[model samples]
Target: MTSGPAIYGNFTIDDLVYPNGSTRWGVPGGSAVYAAMGALLWTKVSSIVAPLGADYPITLLDKRIDLSRCRSIPKTMRNWGLYEEDGRRHFISRNESRDWTYFSPALADAASGYQAAAHIAPLPFEATKQLIEELRAGGTKSISLDMDDHDLLGNRSLKKMMELVSTVDLFMPSQQDVLALFPGKGPLEAMHQLRSLVPEVALIAIKCGAGGTIAHLAGSEEYLRIPAVHVEVIDQTGAGDAFCGGVLGSLARQGDLLEALLCGAVSASFCIEGMGFSSLLEATGEAANSRLERLRQRVERAPCK
Candidate 1:
């Protein structure tokens, strides 16, 4: 459904607390919430395919969640806490993050288009497989997966995990996750080495917290780098998810990989300036577009590459 409905994967609890002091802005966050909200900023309307706790402030859910694509899974909500100091952030609490339980969708989403995306913050590998199967059943056209800062083999079997990646279109992770996966290799070299992991993948976005991001695709001789949007960062918790949310939506909107990457960069630039999804939800598509345009203008003014 070009406009009927959209679905976002992954939902977690995020709490932002200042270690040093309070910032000018802050809010509740999660990779799933931020990205889903980001997608909503442009996609007209969409549903979130996630679960949440029974006590998950029904008001917030009423305000931000669409229940149509939502699935009730175990421990549905995440319990997380974010502490920030001098622009750096640390997660002080986290438990039962990705709790998807089913093997498939109980009811097919009544929509024509499905831009299936998941923040594989280590959802049970079996659940991920089943989720993908469900997406396929629903005729999902594009799928993007993000691996967070965890041992690549922790929650899932290695072979099964790689097989899952092959079935998707975009595979990404934070730069730190890449290092943990393949220790000792320089970032560029490690990216080149990623080819051995997922040869069928389209784009591999490596997110650099507070730094920037770079995308590597198969057959590309060089990595495409996008610098970070400089700002007084309050929290870095959900920025990566925001980037993927932008890529998925923009790619769906324009059918342009490079343009989507640029959008992801611009979206992420906006994601880091605040605590979580609030900053993103606070801006309309027009506002985001204008902000991105200005960022582009700044990019043009930088010393020519």
Candidate 2:
């Protein structure tokens, strides 16, 4: 929020295991990085408010991103990411206890005196709720939350999820999260049910991974499902986080929900084309806008049936 928007999440060292049995070590990975890069594609400034470990590669972040608010911690999160043939991912923490105390810091203290739209990556339910309350209390203009499936499928109840989302302007959950939150239901139906549960959220989007996304505006009968941009898949680690960045960044800058959605899809397209967020971070505004135009042509309103 120093020069522009900010992303709050964790930074991690990722050791990736591919379905083909290939291995990549010492990769920079995290939702915060991917989300910032996604926003940086269209916005001139995107700041990160997260803990940085000594071993993390600071150079991996683009020059446009601001690290002024990032705090130094004993260690950032570290994990091994394993990908399956169906694109399902399994994670194993490198640290015995995961030692994730750095994951949820005092965000309002870290990002003091800032008032801009913010995107929050997945965190524990209580931690996320506290951050949202603090951000709102600090006069943050807008908030977008992307939840973890584990949190949804765990002890966090649907009612608690509803309560948490009501405080934010945007709520984007992956397709897996939606299904788990509403068992025995499809994405669209889950979205509808969620809308009924919390009608105050301005926008609710369900990220369908390679299948694209379906989004609904509060109080509207219509919803739109946009297709993902075709790109050779490399690693899907941070695609969904990148998508949230694009959407929140665009919304904060232009105040256009639909345009935000398109930007998100394009952002995710760039994410999947490389390990971690390398490809996504390499994208420029012109390249992103070009892809947005092409994606705009393919967008169609989904049937409400």
Candidate 3:
């Protein structure tokens, strides 16, 4: 294993329709981009491994992000992010080239030697599983998995989800994903059930958009509720992905999940302050740490009921 982690996901050109009836077109975004930005806030040694194309603007990305592992393709994936007043979002593919959205076996094999930690962003069920397995085989120090709502709602059964969760050191799912896995239950209630359901997972975090994140670590009876840092909400497109990346970044540096959660909260706050990742990209580590210092005052730690 090496010093820094490689984040994997599909690169996309997102056209976002905000709830306030504002529109932004041809925005450079994707899980890997946002996550790498988040991680870079804490550590500069982050690398992104994804499929990029000629259509995507490579210059928009920060120079600190290592792109040598990214696969170069002919066309980038494009999508429309439609948002409603109630914070509901729907993604529609704007590109016919869906096959380039995932890594081929050879690509996955090539990425396996990256060492360090790896964060597999939300991908298809089988593809996510395959990447996790390959990373594990390649001796990654730690692996984190993010859940896709489509994967949970579709053919991926709870049994299969549990199996996948069990294989990773960290399992981060949104509140919606938790509710889907345990219907008619609250996120915290579902979190408790998930911990018991998959005892092998070292950390399980339920990301509640405005309510913040409910995190539980293995062998701990208490749940940590990391509140979201209050900030002007502009475009919240990649907040969750940034949160996961921030967690991994802080964990890599601070070596404490509690501190990592605060880093994530601060990271997400910066992510929503502007359109796309503009605000986050503009933020410096010193600026982020200042926000984290103030946010640390608002953190509430309580025992799981």
Candidate 4:
């Protein structure tokens, strides 16, 4: 594989509450952490731009991940997600210390060398737009975005979402996110409507839990349905973020959409096998390739028109 571009992301800490009344507090969690791990599995140059709190354990991250761009903050960003018995998640609370409502010029400067490709994890609409603008101005070749249900259903305006989508090379959103974005529409209809909203996006990937992903490439009337890898799920947190990382990493290295999708599917499979990025610690390129081959066999392509 060719040398991958420097991958960058934002990070967060999580406080999870399960239906069983158990809780995991102050866990080192975020889209950046999972996405970086997924990218690291394919390439060595990966970094996360986040604010680290005094209480966070920086040593837990892999040595390959560069935290030079991250800031030191008085308190870490905290989020609460309550899981129901039916696998639905409800975010109960959020306390953000360092406001990322707008883009950070310091982060833009730190991201100078790694402009080959970047993945913007779930952030405020304004932040996402600003980051994309900064990266594009800094000569970044490819940019990807991952949107969650919260982002879709939150206070963001449709115009902001459309502008953000049109700016990125790839837009990866969960099934629930798409449903929320285009309410009262089926998956295909929602995807088409989204495509109409952001006709310039090179690819739109809808991530379906357990079922897999449906990816539509620009200028193509057909889309690929890539199935998810079967695994015994331990915790579902960060799976989608890992998937975004895998795709961005693969695309940066190989520039092939199909390969990227497969890599993402495999990465997500590993993420779900254990709790909070633990399974990924034991993941190898060989193992990922093995699963990739299996998933490639199950992928189906059909016309979207």
Candidate 5:
């Protein structure tokens, strides 16, 4: 552990993937950027731990982003590809640019120290565990994880990733990613399968795109469904990450789960109004709270019982 505080997220990126041309495609996607910005909304200091190539931005650690911590390693370069249909998308990642060789606790501290909480997404078991351990050593607990990088249902290749799930406090995943990774039945069935797979997980949240999210954890089986605030959704790229960041960030800073979840949902809702994380990166906490208050009113005013 680096002996400091820093909100952080670890991810794997092949290249920047996003929509382009006639068809919605992924060009250069930035997951760390999205997650870092979202987490920063709540946690005081945020950092990033990931691998990139020479073109990868070593100076990025000190520039542009204000992560209390950040480390981008050099690896063979490549770009990520995305294929979107009807507001939904999938990834065809090639040349994942990360060198597990350089990722370490010392590096993380050197990047962003003296912060609170952490978010680990798009990162595998080893990386996630190492970072968590580092953060924990700094006297930080309560970490949130998005399981998109684990590849859970594929020939048991994600055994290690699955094992690491127990170490996290909040387990997050986009509904589509979970479905694709474990195709079968509906949401309840999917939750059941997930519970069977990662029983230690305190919560399992599935972002339902424009529909919001349904979550169950802490012995709650009612499937807490929180819908996204009605708005003009533009690029849905970072909605899931925003949701995770929103929830964890709020919880870490405010200790309010419902508010955190609501903030997350609102952030996600806001994401659809712009390309990538433009909405989130552009907005402030005051704006988020105002928007969240408005969304809550809509949720409450929604009639038909």
Candidate 6:
């Protein structure tokens, strides 16, 4: 099998608060970790560029993931995810007042000269744009971005978002973030609106949790909706990130968008089966391939029009 593309993103320590009055403190979680895990199932991860504090748990990461370029910063990205009984989730940054910027000469140097596909996980819009710009300049072939809810809600700048979208090959945003990005518009309408803004974007994947995923390839008139796989829900923390990683990794290795989407959907199914990365960690490539084949058959039976 061909080696997977080089993936890059940040690692974060998540403090999850459940409605049952229980808290899982300082758990190893983040877009980078989740994405890396999903990618690792298919191919080797090139490197993870993250800010690691002394308190961050390095043992949780799989040994196959490369972290030689990761930085040891004074503070790691930490956030509190509050799961309410009402089914609403809220994220609060524990280190909101601290500077979380990881862009530097070293970071740029580490990410530079990559000829493979790279996934830029959620971060500030400017920071994301900077990384994309650097990677593109360094001769990276394909790049994907996962838009974070915080960035969309905070920035609220359509122009900046469009600028960033135009630079990436794929743009994956959650349903909530898509709705938040364009108010008063339904999912399809919101996707269309985003397409209007960044018409040059090769693909726009809208992650509708539980409802499935809706994807719009550039030049395709209709959106392709992939039904969600049925599974017992545990924790939905890193599902989107996992999906992003799976899709990018598949695209990098296989170069098939449809197969990439299936990979993403299957990876997300594994994520929600357990809390954090537990289920995903236990998932095997053979199992993933089996699920992918099943999903492909489902898609074929009901081909997107």
Best-matching candidate per TM-score? 2
Per-residue error for 266 in candidate 6, Å, reads 0.8
Q: How high is the CA lDDT of each candidate model? A: 0.58, 0.84, 0.82, 0.77, 0.59, 0.76
Q: Comparing candidate 3 with candidate 4, which one achieves the higher TM-score?
A: 3
Tell me the TM-score of each prediction against the true structure.
Answer: 0.77, 0.95, 0.94, 0.90, 0.75, 0.90
> Among all windows of ten consecutive residues in candidate 2, which has the lowest summed lDDT?
96-105
Task: Choose 4 or 6, whichever is better by TM-score.
Answer: 4
Question: What's the residue-level lDDT of 34 in candidate 2?
Answer: 89
CA lDDT for candidate 1: 0.58
Clashing pairs in 6: none
Which residue pairs in candidate 3 collide?
A: 2-116
Candidate 1's residue-wise lDDT over 114-189, tens digit each? Answer: 5544333334455556666767677777777775344363665556557877877887677766766677765566
- Alpha carbon deviation, residue 107, candidate 6 (Å): 4.7
lDDT of 3 by residue, 1-305 (tens): 13377888878888888877889888889888898888888986788887778788889888888888777777778888999876667777765755543432234543545656788888877777878877877778788888778778887678988998899999988887777788889888898899889887888999998899998988997888889888888788999999998989988887887888899888898999998888888998789999999988887767877
Superposed by TM-score, candidate 2 places the C-alpha of residue 6 at a distance from the truth, in angstroms, of 0.9
For residues 224-305, could you state the per-residue lDDT of candidate 5 as single tens digits?
6677888885667667776776677677778766677777787676666776555665677787778778766543212211
In model 4, which runs have C-alpha deviations exceeding 4 angstroms?
Answer: 1-9, 92-113
Per-residue lDDT over 69-171 for candidate 2, one digit per residue giving the tens place of the 0 to 100 score: 7777766688898888876677677864275545654655444558488888887677788888888888898899998777888986678878998999999
Candidate 1's C-alpha runs over 4 A off are 1-10, 15-27, 58-65, 72-76, 82-122, 151-160, 294-305
Candidate with top lDDT is 2
Error of 1 at 195 (Å): 2.1
lDDT score of model 2? 0.84
Residue 171 local lDDT, model 3: 92
Please report how far candidate 2 places residue 107 from its true position, in Å: 4.1
TM-score of 4: 0.90
**Clashes, model 3:** 1
